[model samples]
Target: MSFDYEKYIRPGKLPHIWCPGCGHGIVMKGLIRAMDALGMKKNNTAIVSGIGCASRLPGYIDCCTLHTTHGRAVAFATGIKMAKPEMQVLCVGGDGDGVAIGGNHFIHACRRNINITYLIMNNNIYGMTGGQFSPTTPTGAKASTTPYGNPDPPFDIAKLAIGAGATFVARGTAYHANQIEKLLVEAIRHKGFSVVEILDSCPTTYGRRNRFRSVVEMMNNLKEIAVSVQAAEHMSPEQMQGKVLTGVLYRDNRPEYVEEYQKVIEAAQDFAG
Candidate 1:
């Protein structure tokens, strides 16, 4: 049976603004499925996002959504999560919005290990903003701003999330649509801060500039280069070269920011009494 996506999407929001062949649509479908599987209540969930193609996801979803300023998704989501710890606050954004201008906020949110989930769509380019090279743009990749190819090294999103102290970190590619939902499900179920990086494709910008020939080729490349974490463990280091690891790369159980903050509040209340 086909899933009822309309139930989750806002009415009359169809004919989305995303360009044809963009992977953002696929990513959104995966999220909808994950939310359905988890029985997420739309009224009790707050979807927050910064400016970008991926961030626009919250606008189309039938939920309490916030389309905030550029690169401040995490910061705003943090405040929402703290103010209403009972709500499931999920932050969404693209590479530029989440890791470039929002880099400081991203890492600090991870450090706090707050009860919020961040879903970052790493298309490697700023698809919505002039096709500029983003923080995750691979060195030598072509973008509108990098006519001669990008000189800066790309960030390993999963590694950054783990290094920054996020309690849960996972990776999925748009090619593996099913895996995206699974990763998101696990991320949401985790207690503390969770980061799921979805390697999406911006066929209009990144693909056209990099000579991928077609969107299919770009998506095929993603499939060919991804290795599941379990499979990667059995492969030699040399064999794993040029291949990105998929699935949950890191997870830890620790004190969540909200619960810990409540302790301070309790102590203050006792002193006052």
Candidate 2:
């Protein structure tokens, strides 16, 4: 597939640093395709990332990218959006960075309904920090730190985003490359806060010790488990158990953060003037 790489990719950054079979590359491809579909100007876009293997996305995209501190992409993105409302801001991070350390900011960002798209590449474990069991690591999954199987239940990121007031919420896996791109495009076009939880695979860290034959096998497993929203609607509780839902889970047209702030400013001005 020939894409206008010059338009969305930085020069000399070809061949990203991600390990072989790492789904971050596939996820980045989807993101670039979505940007192309949206016809968004690279100059007018900002991609922010927190510390993690998935945080390397901003470095590959030709935009106003910020590789911020651990679990702080939301705060950085919020500042970027507030400073330049006209710019389209996208936040990228891993499950641990966004849902664990950055959980507070993530919730607040959803509550604010800021015009930003957050892409969380969830590979189930903390890939960057040596495969520790993260907040999204499935219960009973074994990580380096959880050699005996994790005792804690993992977080449901999509539900959390929706409950926190995110206007648009979607889920896609790296294996479903085309669908991931489509969902990303929709998320970017949405006017309010949007979150797309991408099920990615970390072969070296999360896959090797988890009994996944290879990255390919893990991706195949994701395809097997993912179900579309349309399919989920008719699925019985027994049938839906342990299945991950792909596609848009929820969406709503809500007043954006900046727009609401503007309204408050106007009202205060009217009272004072």
Candidate 3:
């Protein structure tokens, strides 16, 4: 059955600002499908984003949305979650916005195990900022700032989230639209902090600089390199080189911050009584 995506999108916001062939639109559609599948009420859900091309998504979504300062989406989302623990809060950001300038808040949110979901659009370059190499940009990849090719090693966002103590961590690509939606639904249902890293393509910026013939070529590359976690288990290390392991990377049952704080409040009331 076809989903009514218009129900979730703001009507006047049609003809979004993203460039033609940009993968951000696919990621946004996946998110909308996930919300529909979960039957999330717009009134009870909040979307937050920082300054970037990908952050513009909230402007098109029909929900309580916050367009925050650069690299501050997580901080603002944290305040919203604390103020209304019953509401579903989601933070959307680009690779540079979340993993570079906002790296501190990102890890702390994971360590605290807050009941919030973070969807990071990792396109490997600062698409809105002249195509500079981002934290997740592959080593030796050409970018506006690295015309000679980037020499720095890129950070694996999934590994970083797991190391920072996120309760749930997963990876998906824009090429796998259905899988992205499924992973998002599970992430939203998880009790503690959840991070879903989406490997999206910025055809206008990253693709042109990387010598991709077209958006289809870039997408095909993603499909070729992305391997499910289960399939990866059967491959040798040498064979796994240059492959991106997708699917749920890690998960654990941990005490969420809001629930733990409520316990303290209950204990204090009991003592007073």
User: Could you estimate the TM-score for every candidate?
Assistant: 0.98, 0.97, 0.98
Which regions of candidate 3 are displaced past 4 Å? none
Per-prediction backbone clash count: 0, 0, 0
User: Comparing candidate 1 with candidate 2, which one achieves the higher lDDT?
Assistant: 1
lDDT value for candidate 1? Answer: 0.93
* Decoy 1 TM-score against native: 0.98
lDDT (0 to 1) per candidate: 0.93, 0.92, 0.95
Looking at model 2, how many pairs of residues clash?
Answer: 0
Q: For residues 17-52, what per-residue lDDT tens digits would candidate 3 score against the true structure?
A: 899988899999999999999999999999999989
Tell me, by lDDT, which candidate is best: 3
* Alpha-carbon shift of residue 104 in model 1 (angstroms): 0.5
Candidate 1: 10-residue stretch with minimal lDDT: 126-135
TM-score-better candidate, 2 vs 3: 3
User: On a 0 to 100 scale, what is the lDDT of residue 169 in model 2?
Assistant: 99
| Candidate ordering by lDDT (highest first) | 3, 1, 2
- Name the regions of candidate 1 deviating beyond 4 angstroms: none
